[model samples]
Target chain A: MTAMNPKLIALDWGTSSLRGFLMGANGAVLEQRGSPHGITALPEPGTAGFEAAFEALCGEWLDRWPALPVVAGGMVGSSQGWREAPYVRSPADVSRLAAEAMEVPTRRGLSILIAPGVLSHPSGGAPDVMRGEEIQIAGALRLHPQLAERGHFLMPGTHSKWVDVRDGRITGFETYMTGELFAVLCRHSLLGRLMPAEAAAPEVAEAAFTRGVEAARHSRPGDLAHQIFAARTLGLTGEMPAAALRDFLSGLLIGQEVLSALGHSAQADTPLALIGEEGLCRRYAGVLQRFGAVPALQLGNTAPAGLFHFAIAAGRVAAAGEPAR
Target chain B: MTAMNPKLIALDWGTSSLRGFLMGANGAVLEQRGSPHGITALPEPGTAGFEAAFEALCGEWLDRWPALPVVAGGMVGSSQGWREAPYVRSPADVSRLAAEAMEVPTRRGLSILIAPGVLSHPSGGAPDVMRGEEIQIAGALRLHPQLAERGHFLMPGTHSKWVDVRDGRITGFETYMTGELFAVLCRHSLLGRLMPAEAAAPEVAEAAFTRGVEAARHSRPGDLAHQIFAARTLGLTGEMPAAALRDFLSGLLIGQEVLSALGHSAQADTPLALIGEEGLCRRYAGVLQRFGAVPALQLGNTAPAGLFHFAIAAGRVAAAGEPAR
Candidate 1:
């Protein structure tokens, strides 16, 4: 009674949340589910807790297709997750990433392979690393092969990644704590004291954000610490409304990140491929466009695409089959 | 019998703590006292609560010299403080600062003048302001008049100030949130999670700090956010000890601040006058020296000296008297 189409399960398990995607042989998503039981939320560090959470999240799919192989990525493969899938150093590609996947046995007969994160050792700088984003990058290259030829990819989130891809491989990348800094400043710093208690409306946020971007564009790199205080001054001077302070701060941080990335990279004028959630990606895209970098937006989640690519490369899923197009 | 020496009280009343200096007419500290009852801890926002806290901290001195005039600086003059002393726009000197001091009536028939903060509008940049640090700058100038000729003064603290003084007046200044960012990162950010619970010892902190400073000196300004993550990676890689992470972070932030300030100012090669608490000032002096800026350390409390200068300029105290030397 098994379904005619063979399927594979791809899980994007992170520190605080988990997403399970059931995909057909051709990389088409069959069913998807999410849960808060991420690595940090699992009962314990052992196989039992991980299996329990995994089953709870995807037991229905397993019931429909008992032998579906699961490929998980992100924190689920970190030291604290279900199993430690050691990081693969750059320059890395889908093949190396897939080859490095760690296998774990489940109570049921299903096989699970966890994709490894990527690390880069800059010649004279501190090492850079990324976990889930590498999977997304793999998926991005699969979706837009043109990105592999030569392009920068920006995955904006808590720790935004500015990645450089050359000849279908990740050459190097830099991670900016822009998102985290924005959150901390808005929630914990004196600047946060001036923001409205609730979130600002979209239009209000957009306007303030634009102002912040403009400010950063005209400022020197060393002036960030000083520029941040402008949030308070602008509010006090009645030039910027208090409600817009939060978005303004967000815009400033993001704008600074973009400027910093461009200043550090050789691809300032080259178009960037942005892959992430719509809202954040759109925000990044807008800022990029404002700064004169053409940003090609690839919306919707890419973890499934990444996981599916890794699955096929690992020989867990047949590569010859057509996706359910 | 009233004290043989006529005296003035210099109060450094900030948000979290209060310090009162009983100064002789000759600008020598006769007695000093401190209390936890800062502006924030005062019972209420009005004059009554302020008076109560003031009495609790300095009632002894007031009793000794019943008609002594009090010169207060710092947050005590903010809108949330005892009385709003409007900020004097720069390029300001002690004269301009003294002219803008606000007077408030006390229950004991004593006069209180709160010295104004300084505001800087850097032409194309946002306005910058500082409350207590302006007083310190005045004191630094008074202690060593050479500083006024032309010098860069770094007052390192929660909101570190880099001041440009020329010809006995404050021309411009920039504020860096180094200390606050360190606190927030070590207490709230993921970086904090990897640090030891207790503060690092001086020697340990110094070594780690030097390393951080060196790393920062060689890095591009845009790479700071990425470089900060090196704290985590270094810990993971066992290149940096866990106990030293705090100091390393402190070093990295201070180093970045120094670099940024120098980069933004015209005084890169000029010796820096560091005025603040001994420990923080020493830390800054070391970092400054490492970066090839001759750091002249002005130790001990400068608030009293600053307050004395303001008292004389405002005509609350006689101008011809020499400071006790």
Candidate 2:
């Protein structure tokens, strides 16, 4: 797809990977690009390498249409990114991204705006931070105005974010490094060594996942590490499927977030909206319900939606927006 | 040391390595040998390559002291060991080793006896198991009868074990897997990626260790995985010593064990005795005290002393037996 007259280039750059969508003024995707390169791959933090990597991946589209404005989010705004865009603490409006936006210096005549992440530090729970999900959540709300009212939002990715919204503003959120930890533990840690040669069926993982979440809710938190060993023992003794161990681990993590969320506020049964990989998000929704949260899984490219919505609200979008590229 | 009168060889093999000590009828150290061969390294589990590896390392001793009576302990009796020496449930006696021993039919004309590890399902705490530490602890008690009474026993190694004793029997114990996890986390996990090029300094590690123990006591136990990020964050922010993260990690593990122990028992002020590397043991004592446990750090070679004492009690040596060769 040619970027001839795309309204905006929305980019989601995180720790280990990057994704971008060329969107029309109406918030419809015209073209998309994704790569393994992420903020973590930069040779030097906050160096030209960041720009070089992005240019290498997205230069073709930009060359086809030189005047397209860009809005980027995720780890691209951290201290190690192109420019440090400080987090806006909740309660935050969708316009916060545009309001607190940091301009990136570019060699090409392209105006690029990097959206800052959001941080929520309530009194009891651990301080949660996000860079990319904020833009998506904002976009999701823009797509469906009804979500502006009270609802729980789950943005699932490497560092899965669960955000709470009320009256068109983000009330607070929590970050669970679920995906990253799963990869690390499953591929690198002792747990990986103990895992069987073959992964179990998804049905097994699903069951284990459910049990794990429930276990996390009832058990003392410190007992989690030991419980992992129990999974292996059960498997070794022919009591549990190995695939379920992976689900159990996932359950433990998500269950922990659910438990922490419960600890933070009294609204445990609030309806939850999820934005993430379909399967993983469904797993999380299932876990949320286990902890008494009503959750709904949503589908869409949230970054572009969020960037476009937030950009328009912040008056960053040009008046002569192109709805058709 | 020559195997002048090697009567039998007592071996304590584990997951990663093997140790065999040759003794005369008096349970005296005739000659000792260790090798890279561990239970994991063996060609197959359950004693297939056990004899060959044993003979390869100390065959000379066996030949010199012809027709020796061999007694082994630890993983040698595990499912992964030479033979599955079934676990002996507590309250177990030393005579159980000689009476219920699993004998390996050897090609070297040596009558090999493998000691059974201990397994206990405490009425209060989660089920626990011991492999080599049971024998070592038994040996330590044989050497120091006073310690057989109510006191604390710390056997620090890969899976560092903290054992509790009351009235001449092991009431309960907890295995921290501290060393094993430390090695895994430092070399394999994402946490290791954040470590400085140099090793953590002793002083810095010591300080972090104390703080970590305190944090473990007061912090939400379920938040440990996230809390680990603090090690890197503290170092990055210059709020904590960079090299001390290792110490902090150690402290956290030990602190967790201490917390678990105190949680399950009514007596928190029972005298503590640590048996491990002098420095590590001392550090453990310090952290234990910081977390409100009265501890005593003992200076000694864990394996030799523990083995010696355990051998005498296991009846490998008669009361009037000759000194170790």
Candidate 3:
């Protein structure tokens, strides 16, 4: 039963970094490796660069199991990646995503399974799309089947997503640019001038953050442009130190995002789940706790779990109890 | 009456540029000069820099009228300017601003009157402020006294302000960082990536802008961080060109500011006025018209007019039909 050898190479690639997961027959991670070579961070350009990064991060594993199936997700499957994988329209399920897993033939006669992204078109709005988070959602659903009955999956990161899953199918979702907004404001706006480059002490930062959350939560609709100025004024008034402004901004943005969610999607007595980085998830959890809609499941690195599910469904790999392909 | 020669020197000094106005005995502007030397853009640093900028901008006018009163308003009275003129609390009027003008003694043997800024403490919120706008309000009140009776004065710029005035006094005001937010996001956020560095066709830009304003106006409260993402999505989806994104963003932010104002301050059939740059004020006017609260009075560069009002009140210059001081 020491067959924990890598049965699949799962790669999660994005704008800034790439993470590879060596998954076993049972969808468990056997080993993990990471690289700074994201789709845009390649040592070289185009397919050659992607190939080099892939080799650098997973060459040894590939050398040991030359025929092992490889699955790549995130922006790596976008128009700018090694090979493009088209997005699966919303209301899609596991079979659709698996059926859409693209193949890129390599010189070694190996086919890399590129995960397709998900796109949703809300009436009278621009189409919303996601590539990596789709995989994460699949993994979350695979990890906890009960979560599929009815729930809102909150994935917090550069571009956060609030996904609606019902009867085990993603019916719809929306993307909130909270993290990117926070970064742009803190790095470029006048508000960033007083904020020092250093991090503040924990308890003080948390308190400041909570204050920001409370402010955003209680503010009126269309008040963000008005209220965010407080981040500067509060510091100028000597009510809070510069060190705590970052967290305060974080809490304010997340609080507003949560407030918007409470208006329709994430609500009282409804199932919710948090997925992404641990600290980010914890922050979302804490903010949601304020709204009294605590996430039912908190998971991390669900991309590999999601890929495993897709691979099995696509027949790229056998079932969990069966022998490895 | 040909003595329209400079009777007073008024300078509206702000962060990026300075405007100097030479006034006659009756408060009519005899001449005007502009300098790129704002508080933060002086040729040198500190008082020396400020003095140099002042000398470069007004040395000729001062030489001709050595006894002329020199009055300055805006950031020139900020803590980092020639001298700090502390803020006058809300419920302030022209007389309060005139009476509190601080004089900075210069090596040139002339007293430079600095306008004090206005501050308001909203219950359970951070204090709000405006240094130059108070001067503009004073000018507006002097220009059209009926305006001060009951009106919401909208001052749109990097930081937009909605002032509640009643019975000839500024009762309260709130600041919105709309222009600043739009600038930061378009220059630094992902939304800016697709935006080209050139201007789009005017008619196309205006339509896009109106679309953005409509979106923001219709969005739910706390929905800005969500709605703004459309700036990127709409471009990616080919519903809009990259050139139109800037205008769209401008409209969205202004729409949000207007939305918040209408929520409490700016309402239908109420007296309203706009004081700021012509283009910005026009944008606000357009957005407000969408809400059926068109500005009643629209004025440009009211700071000098404000200075003239303050100068007469402070006895720096003789009133109309009076002899020169």
Candidate 4:
């Protein structure tokens, strides 16, 4: 049998979704695949279930490149996931994250390095933690080296994160349940019943979203709980169209998030880095700009690049690497 | 059959539950019945479905008291309910709510007066409205006439309301989705997964709840979305026990609501009137007191009494009427 060569396989395994990327040494994607079989989808906890799911997703690539190293992150490292990778407390850097990576044995004798999440504890308060986001943070730092000096990074998603980075390390962070709360309100609450069943067009939503952001900006920060009810009353009075209620809600929530994040720090005048999907990042950028903060947008997939960066940092991949093309 | 006589049938038909009261002329409850067949549970909308659910729950009582007028409130008066009773704009008094009541025809040739909800619009912001709570406010006014001069009333429920009363009229009000948000978070979000399935004991929960209130009091208002994530991280770090998460969440939400309410009004030092069920009102009072606001607690059922007050104000029953026992 001929010896096969590949640079690396990167995986982002969250609670309900998984994405796998096969990449070249130059950080170019060779192939990409995804599945709903995330860490939560495993039939059971432990190595067997993790191995089965991983094999189903990337076994063919492993068969081809028998010695290729695999890098993974996200909920797959939590206590509930395949193996518990203890969180490295912030202020954490790429080196600290790499040092805390846990190794798991695969049936096919392949190397799997799982990156650890970072936890932050404020003075005299409960702690906050993030897993896969740490990887994305690393990737963002690599792409925009200038961001390493000092900046706030906003990652929008379910449990959106606002991270404080100083000198290339995550000094501290906080999580906002903005996305998750939006989903719940839309699907399970009375406010959702008033919205149109289908989402409004992007342009229509963007306008309503702008109105929501403006409203949030003008209102007192504590009034968020009160302001949210406007989503219902506006529809009731025909002031806001029914189709636009969803976007308006999205804006209200995201606006509150931005306001809250700003309230915690005095960096509103400085440029804030946005790390996430293009659509969400664009929306967040719009809100931040409206709220008097300069927003610097970063688009594209960061998890795979982040995993690759982690692998290099951990010395699993050689510093000077080449594609096998 | 002889024309039967009673004071009035007071009904609280909300979105998800119904309560019917057979009362004496002096506002004494002679009989009471309730069911989960709220307006939303009606087999249909318009008159037909509402009649079916109403008859199923209170048909026998109505049959006996053929001449008794029925006063209904809550979502039963909303556009989605049996009939739409237009909202009376604030600053409105009990007389204004009574004047706006809409009468619907019934199979038994009886009059059913549905009281109107109240809507408040701040000069340049979105409007806020509440239905059943309007009746509760009227009842509170009757019980504590002093409140009519000037007072802020806090009604804790799914959509908690902070109402301002001045000079015998409801000047304005704000709605907070605190209770509803708590339910959604505990039942649908990732934070819920960390809480104990069963609720904690009263004493244990009280301590945790107090901690949550203190935490909220010290933190910035807009940080609630961020603060909620503590429920998960605390459990992860074993800083907070799983059984206590539910109460802790309850405290966090209620604390935010109280804080937001206080932020809107200049009457923080004045005692805030609490109108709701005993358990929830007690919790709100505790949080309010902990946050340095004086809480004036009102217990017992307010809906029925409010309905009777509306009936009297609307001249449905004579001012000097007596029960035909």
Name model 4 segments beyond 4 Å from true.
A1-5, A43-46, A201-203, A268-271, A321-325, B1-5, B43-46, B56-65, B269-271, B320-325
* Best model per TM-score: 3
* Every model's TM-score: 0.94, 0.83, 0.96, 0.93
Worst 10 residues of 2 chain A by lDDT: A316-325
Clashes of each: 1, 10, 1, 0
- Model 4 residue pairs with clashes: none
B40-62: candidate 2 lDDT, tens digit per residue: 88755445587678878778776
List, residue by residue over A1-325, the lDDT tens digit for candidate 4.
Answer: 2332458899999999889998776556788899888887885566788888899899998877777888899999998877788999999998898899998888888768899999999889889999989999888877777888997888998889988999999999999999998899889987988987877787887888988888877766457777888889999999878999988988888988888888887665445888888888887887877877877756466787788788888876765553222
User: Model 3, B112-225: lDDT tens per residue?
Assistant: 999899888888877788889998888888788888778788898889888988888888999999988988898889899989998889998999999989988787767888
Using lDDT as the measure, name the better of candidate 1 and candidate 3.
3
True interface contacts retained by model 4? 0.71
lDDT of 2 at B174: 62
Can you write out model 1's per-residue Cα lDDT over B20-109, one digit (the tens) per residue?
988876678877888887888876666888989888887877786787888999999998888899888999999999888998888888
Task: Sort all candidates by DockQ, best to worst.
Answer: 3, 4, 1, 2
Task: Please tell me which predicted candidate would have the highest DockQ against the true structure.
Answer: 3
Residues B139-187 of candidate 4: C-alpha lDDT, one tens digit per residue? 8877777777888888888888899999888899999988888898899
Give candidate 1's chain B TM-score: 0.93
What Cα-based lDDT does every candidate model obtain? 0.83, 0.68, 0.86, 0.83
Prediction 1 TM-score vs. true: 0.94
The residue-level lDDT of candidate 1 at B221 comes to 40
Candidate 3 residue spans exceeding 4 A from truth:
A1-4, A322-325, B321-325
